[model samples]
Target chain A: MKVVTKDKGVYSFSPAHKPVEYVKPGELIILETEDAVGGQIKSEDTPLESIDWSRVNKATGPIYVEGAEKGDTLVVDILDIEVADRGVILVVPGAGILGDSKFEPRVKIAEIRDGLVLFDGLRLPMRPMIGTIGVAPEKGEIPTATPHRHGGNMDCVEVMRSARLYLPVFVDGALFAAGDLHAIQEDGELCVASIEVEGRILLRFSLIKHKAPEWPIVELDDHYSILTADEDLDKAVKLASEQAVKALMRAKGWPFEKAYMFGSIGVKLAINQGVDPKKGARAIIPKTLVTLNDLLIESD
Target chain B: MKVVTKDKGVYSFSPAHKPVEYVKPGELIILETEDAVGGQIKSEDTPLESIDWSRVNKATGPIYVEGAEKGDTLVVDILDIEVADRGVILVVPGAGILGDSKFEPRVKIAEIRDGLVLFDGLRLPMRPMIGTIGVAPEKGEIPTATPHRHGGNMDCVEVMRSARLYLPVFVDGALFAAGDLHAIQEDGELCVASIEVEGRILLRFSLIKHKAPEWPIVELDDHYSILTADEDLDKAVKLASEQAVKALMRAKGWPFEKAYMFGSIGVKLAINQGVDPKKGARAIIPKTLVTLNDLLIESD
Candidate 1:
């Protein structure tokens, strides 16, 4: 099938967006997406407020894949990210985790020069990835600021190119929307900004028919990440551990007690987003240390 | 000149408790301190309402160091840790970040088996370090649970052997107190309970005259860590960045604005402790990444 071009603003997921009508396990779909700001902020733009907020973080089309059911998992294979011309921007404003008083008005722009993100006389190797990508939430329209079960605004740097993000399907057609492309960002993006740039995001999606998790479970090549949020870091970790245990139970058919015990023995926790002061804390638990072979579950 | 051994009775750091005489920097001091529970709960002790709340987290003596005055930095180098032949126990009750509802009565004992901390069938490589060690607050005596500028209960895992922690001297003689040794603990010790053990803590202190931070700073072989505690992670990172900027400014002689801009260009922020639940959020900026050469400060 021919890939969709940019002129077609409204791309249908069934035939136009997805490369193939039916996606097999480990299948790939390289869907290209626009930048988070949607060309609102340009290099010549002086004041940041000149950019409209309503159009910011406008995601790509809802990439619908065949055989992606509610209980299935959509493995988004982020193959490659290419910056055509303009680079990303890092802005600190009143809306983010850092309130107005702490941050002064400053805009840091990046230029993809010689395959590197050049910012303020420093060259940062670009590792581009989608900042916000998720299926529709159950209740109200979730903003791009918060990360939910749908896997929006995860901002985890490890989910860069070549990483596989396993998102649980919610609504029919999965209604996957992805954008907010970043050139490079630290784990928490504590500044509430990154080298946000206009780039083309290419990702392939595959369908895995498994029981849906209560939340999103991301699996990179060597690591398994469980997204969890809580009022505090301690509670966030506990909630993450609980989610890990639940994932373990689902994957291994072990009892809750056994999963809990096993987690205490082997599970290691990592903080994903600690700088977002208001919404409590967010973290991810990688399953690299915990082997499926060690569990009671049989591999496919 | 001579190191003092354990004194009889519970060693307390209160004003009423006897002060341990000072030694020069780089001199080893062996201290014997009660567990965080302060002997209220023993090996076989069960959770009960009779526990003394004030006695909990009672620190050892305020080992007054010789030549340690205000404006000097106390470099506490952890030398060694040796748990008693018996063991230690961990209990989850009113302690930790979890509320009373999630509280459960459970105990796990630790034993040194095969050079590893053994609890039931689990064998964890021992990484022993004092949990609470700091100078008396400038204003008055502060509880060990609340970590402050004095470095009480930082619960930083990096404070292990070979890692030198620089504490700011507030009062004369730098009244140093140390206790709450844990055999092994994850970053946050989320349960608020690590393998709490009664172990002999051996530490050497070195005085860096005329060099003290507003808050404590930790230095390992490869990285420098700034300690800051705030309700929000973003604020904590900002505090850490501010400290790093100041350090860079002092080291390079750059203006504050230049230092801040330089930091944005170079430094990498890491989430130090997102598990503390209460004080879990910490950010570490790598000194190597910052352009120290641009700053006009001299390096020692």
Candidate 2:
């Protein structure tokens, strides 16, 4: 077990360019995180006339997982989250999907009180979840705010407690970094923000070899989730459906057409993320009616 | 209130097509309903090899609401549901989103025991909600299975108890009919079906003269919802965003651009329906973020 702190813009223990050592499954690692804005703004601070957008959204790590190959899945088991006295603030400028002209001089502040995030006289149950948690993509550095195949900024609420997130290991060691904690957020976070806050997160990581998905997949207590993103909701849904069908096919060994038909006839589809315009849509196909054990998987 | 029953594909009612009427902001009305199949299939009966598709979704009646004019909004308040001994069943074949392929023969049976619908091995908390409740469309008779401006076959689980559903009125009397009760369902009944059953429903209807929206709007406690459907998810989301902007503009008299901007900066979106291939997407917007009080036409 190891503990690390991120002060200002520097990490207490910065790793070199090489891959960091891996920690086995059920190992506890604690990381103290900063607010999404990196403490640039305070509670009494007024809305910025012009924000230094570039300085925001800094992730904490490329913490390498041991033995995690390209095709393997990195299981991030979120153990617990401790919110700081100060939380996150959300601002929507002119560049979002609704565009900029409609919202102006908008600033909403949330406070963590009695285990709840209070915003605009509404008491949202404080369900601390990560705003951005993912691995590095194969190419250039992907912005922490943008969600992609590497699972950045998913803004998915169900990734909260007791959920095991299985992310595809794109690069070796699966350079993992997580920050931008939210006290509470709806699925879309339509207003483009949630109760963003600084927090301490405890996560347990495990590596599964030779078991990587083309995209990320999640398995919770009662449901299985498939994540897919596209600039278009239709295309995104189609991609998600295709992936879900493929998962079903692999799990059930049913013919492709039969899997598709079973999905159409028995599965349930849910929209996971839609507010992020860049990654137009994300859907989840839950194996609710059909039991996973009923399907016989034929090894590839 | 009127009582009706169907036996052997034949129905008899005390008040037949006599336009059941209620006022705006009225209390819940209890209606005794028949199954979607209209008694064509029974508890012991097997799935029909060929269901009369036309007759598969026959609803109870066109209950005309008093003072509901074209362009007005009808608020249907679901109160409670009481399922009978035997419920409904779903069979997938040539119809549905995956109509292109054949699936294995699967059957699910349901029973109501002590206010719970026991389906398979799960005891789903009975939250009786309508699967087909709507006004007559401006066009010719639309099937009970398809949803349109009239709000037919919405199958939205949130439209249950304590939720207020607003339907845009098309015809003079606002011919409202409701049936196809379900015990429970997720956001998208990806199986293209739910725990469909025959149940007694209690609902209250009210009318709002000048508050009719361009599309359906639902209010569940503090959250507001907008339903949209298109050939694709992007278009569907765009349509939903546009509708949400329109609702905000109409309610707050903000400029269209401002509404869009406000939505971009402040709203949250959720997928309401995805089972239908033709139209699959629903977006939810919070009323608190959008300044609706500015356009308040004498608040209720």
Candidate with the greatest lDDT versus the true structure: 2
Candidate DockQ values, in order, are: 0.26, 0.24
TM-score of each: 0.82, 0.75
Give the share of true interchain contacts found in each model.
0.05, 0.29
Scored by Cα lDDT, where does model 1 land?
0.59
- lDDT (tens digit, per residue) of candidate 1 on A26-54: 55544555666666666634567676766
Model 1 TM-score relative to the real fold: 0.82
Weakest lDDT window of 10 consecutive positions for candidate 1 chain A: A7-16
Q: Tell me candidate 2's interface RMSD.
A: 5.1
TM-score of chain A of each: 0.78, 0.86
Cα lDDT for residue B157, model 1?
70
